[model samples]
Target: MIRYRFGQDDVLRTRFAIAPLMELIGAFYVLRRPERYVVHRRWLKWAASRVGDLDLTLLDAAAPFGGPYWPVFVSPPPREPHATIEAELSRVRETPPERVLAEITHRYPDRLPAAARPFAGDPAGALGELVEQMRALWDAVLGPRWVTISALLESEIASRARSLAALGSRAAFADLHPSVSWEAGCLSVRPTSKSATDVNLAGRGLLLIPSAFTWPTVWPRIDPPWDPALVYPPTGIGDIWEPADTDHGALKSLIGCRRARILQELDRPAATLELAARMRVSAGGISDHLSVLRRAGLVTRRREGRRVVYARTLTGDALCRPST
Candidate 1:
């Protein structure tokens, strides 16, 4: 069992973040283990043809053998809540050669994946090549759908943040994943493998990262020189590929199809343009619908920075709640 010993400071220092590249890496697992991730079967079938002949042996090798030691340079914890893929890739590019070599050698001392072996001779060049390939893979497979994916991730973070505030850390961690448990100030993660491990936060704290792709299990990154983190599947991943639940027939009967969907989609606050993209409607039309909903006391609008975000009110929530 992995134990994360947290001091008072560690508890205060804990934070949450969303990682785009981490999702890309997690997608590799989904591709390899479709049976384990049945919700993503459609995505798996679609992604299979798009991934082409890209090499993922290095990522595969990084998976837990006796221990989980993913190359830190590749999947470092995010510095902020909303880090861009470009910025994270830059960090990977700037990773010192020695660090890369150390991680590679430590993970595969004798035999290495064919894709990672070349890094031993020229860590800088080979690692750079790997990063480029990762970028291409992201563009081809995930970039197009990042909007919907990121929205789902952000919604999960917001919900967890609320839980942390209202119910405290223990309740928050308890709800993170089935394999995850917190007791006596230590957070334990039981992954799919039979191996049991212990990780101590040592007052360094932890980063809770919500990922759309890392479903069915919670993945831990406890290697040294990197802030410890728990990467777990976020809620609502099943809806990522499925169509929006616009079949709110009762809701449609009351508010019309477009407005009912707008209400359904507002489970999380979103701006007009984002709503437009998700609903496949024009900004002007969404604005009109939001105006009506706001007037009817079904939705409210607030400015988040320069954008006007809309969210359903309590009355709206009651209306949208599924009938028992």
Candidate 2:
């Protein structure tokens, strides 16, 4: 999905997402997952500058905030926004999927992770990898612990829509983004894409990535908004953006770590060293991969004071569909 659009009032929209962003950096954040966290921060930084210019253009030249484009959300109705949006899009009529995708691709690179766009030469293959990479990214994010946070935030934002969905109304956002919905009694948010500009980044791979802008991407059916506005950084900020591809090849496990198989092997929570023994990997190596998985939302870690324990998240459990 690698969708690059978001609602104007996304719940996670932070004016200063930079600080929390800094916390998740380094090996603990990077190698754990592949492109997601890797690309997200760059997008955020680039997009930050873009938003100021976009808002200035919109609020000043395009039209007033109250015109057709600006829809208010002061206690809006459940599922109403999504449904209304569908109708509005219908009013615009169906544009060619290729054109729609192209416009998004052209606009998104600056606002999204540079990895999102497929490498120039192999656009199709790059797009497929991008989508799949993005989906993998979602699997890591929107999982259990995240679901708890998502639920809390949804309650704060989409209290009514969530309530109505429970009572049965189309697809709930939870169904699309399992991690965000992994928690019981949590509210799910579907994408409205209002005020959110679309960037195709071209959905080439799997996992239904909702936005490349947000790392550990998402799997919302309606593609919930993450960033408030489409951000575009000025050129020469870094490397010239290229469409993402597995050109360098998939990342190697940090020596002796096969955390996925280890997690797959476990039936219960296990100590790092214990799983390390089972996986035949060195304790240090297991620790490193566990750290990676932990960041990827694949596995989780908790300190029993001196010792740390790792386990799979509900999203992981669902994904693994482990035998009971």
Candidate 3:
């Protein structure tokens, strides 16, 4: 059990972010243990053939026996909503040499992998190589589908934020993962490992990160040099690997093909531009369809900053739900 004690300031400062490189690293775990992430088995098989040449020596050693410190260097917590892979890699490149050596030693107290031993002497040079390999792996495995992946992640964040607002922090944390709980002034995480741990926010706050690949469990990073953070699987990850299913013939007949397809896609709320890009239709066309759906009481639009996002209503949900 890991407990994070939150001070008054810490509670106010708690923020959420999306980490792309973290998803890439979690995908590696899915590749190694498909049974643990069966929902992503299809993606694992597909990514395996494509990332054959990418070197994952560092990542492999980092998680030896399921530890957290090593992967933190590769996928450090993001400070903002729009963090890019390039920016995260730059931070990894600048990590102090001593920190790298310390984490490697901690992860492999007995014997370290040959690929990682060279880093003890020259951490900077070794990290540069690791970054290049990670970039290549990202391009091969995740870059093409990042648009869809990021949208899913963003939607999860928005949902959690709503939960935080409507249901309060404790309820929101409980909903994040089955292993998470809130008690007293501390947030606790019960991970699969036997090691029991405790953390104090100390007014630094916690960063809640939503991940597409880190399913079936929540991961915590509590060590120094990185902010305290939790990485939990998002709500709609089951649909990430599966192709969009919008071929409900009956519904299609009722609403017409295009609008029915649009309604079907609203299983999750999305912005006009995002729907447009996914459907390969112009934004204007999607807007017209959304307007019609809104009028018919099948969909509703809510203003989120500059974008007006659309989501299926309860009435629309009944229409889209598979009939018995």
Candidate 4:
């Protein structure tokens, strides 16, 4: 059990952010143990195909399977919400050489593993290589899907913010996850760590991060030189990987077949060109349909970097339900 004692300052300082590097790390872990994370099976299948030819030897060794902890410098907590992947990777590259050696030693106190020898021998050289591998993974496997993933994470934060306003912090924390609890000015998390740990939030507030790949568990950071953070699975994450149901004949009839097909394709937030390619329709036609759907309150649109993605709203989701 990990307990975090919150002072008056701590409560005021608590904030939320979306960490791209952390999400990438979580996705890599899912790849390592796909059987354990059945919820991400669909995503695993897609990602596996994309990275089949790429060499990930270093990343695999850095984040080995079944370990209670990985190196902290590999993925330090994000300082702000909406941090770009480039910015996060830059931070990892700038980690002090001493910190790298210290973390490597701590992770392997008895005998250094053969794969981790490079870090112990030459921290600077090894770190540069590691960062290159991580960057390649991002470009090949995660960069394309980042927009959709970011939208899902943003939606979770918006929903939680509403809850915080209406029900207060205690209620928000309680609903965060089954393994978390709060009482008497303390927040407790039952993490995968076997040891018991306690932390006082001193003055720096807690950073709450919502993650799609961190499903089925919550992670906490309580080390020095960094603000405390908690990463937990977000609501409606099960649907993040599920493909759109293509057999919505009834829906197709109510809204013209083309519009209905467009709505169905938005199972996980997609852009105009993507929808056009999947449905084999012109991009202009798809945009016209999306505009009508958006105005009708069935779908909503948002810009993610250079692309504008669309997703079904609550009413839109309800309309997709198959009639009895």
lDDT of each: 0.76, 0.34, 0.77, 0.80
Q: Could you tell me the TM-score of candidate 1?
A: 0.71
Could you give candidate 4's per-residue lDDT for residues 1-324 as a string of tens digits?
Answer: 888899888877788899988888888888878898998887787788777776676666666655666778888878777787888999999998899888887877888878888888898888888889888888876775664577678788988877776887797788899999999989999864757888888877788999988998888877655578899999888876554443577788888889987877776679999999999989999999999999997887866679887887655665663432
Per-residue CA lDDT of candidate 2, range 1-324, in tens?
Answer: 123332333322212111111111211233333354444344334333433322121112111112222111111112221122223223222333353344334544345333333333344444344333333332333222232222222222343245333643223333333233312322333233334433432221111212222333232222222322211111121321222232111222422326556656443557888987787779897777777777776665555547666666543444443221
What residue runs in model 2 are displaced by over 4 Å at the alpha carbon? 1-257
What's the residue-level lDDT of 275 in candidate 4? 94
Candidate 4 local distance difference test against the native: 0.80
Rank all candidate structures by their TM-score, best first, as comma-separated numbers. 4, 3, 1, 2
After superposition, candidate 4 runs with Cα above 4 Å error: 245-324
Q: Is candidate 1 or candidate 2 better by lDDT?
A: 1
Model 1 C-alpha lDDT per residue in residues 1-324, reported as the tens digit of each score: 556677777777778898977887887777776788887876777788888687755555543323545677777778878776878888888989998888888877778767677778888887787788778878777875565577577678889888877887897888778778888788877653535666666777888899988877677776556578878888766656764333368779989989999998887668999999999989999999999999997887756558887877645665664532
Give the number of colliding residue pairs in candidate 3: 0
Q: Name the better of 1 and 4 by TM-score.
A: 4
Residue 150 of model 3, lDDT score: 70
The C-alpha stretches of model 1 lying farther than 4 A from their native spots are 53-67, 191-202, 245-324
lDDT, model 1: 0.76
What is the clash tally of candidate 1? 5
lDDT of 4 at 113: 79
**Which is the leading candidate under lDDT?**
4
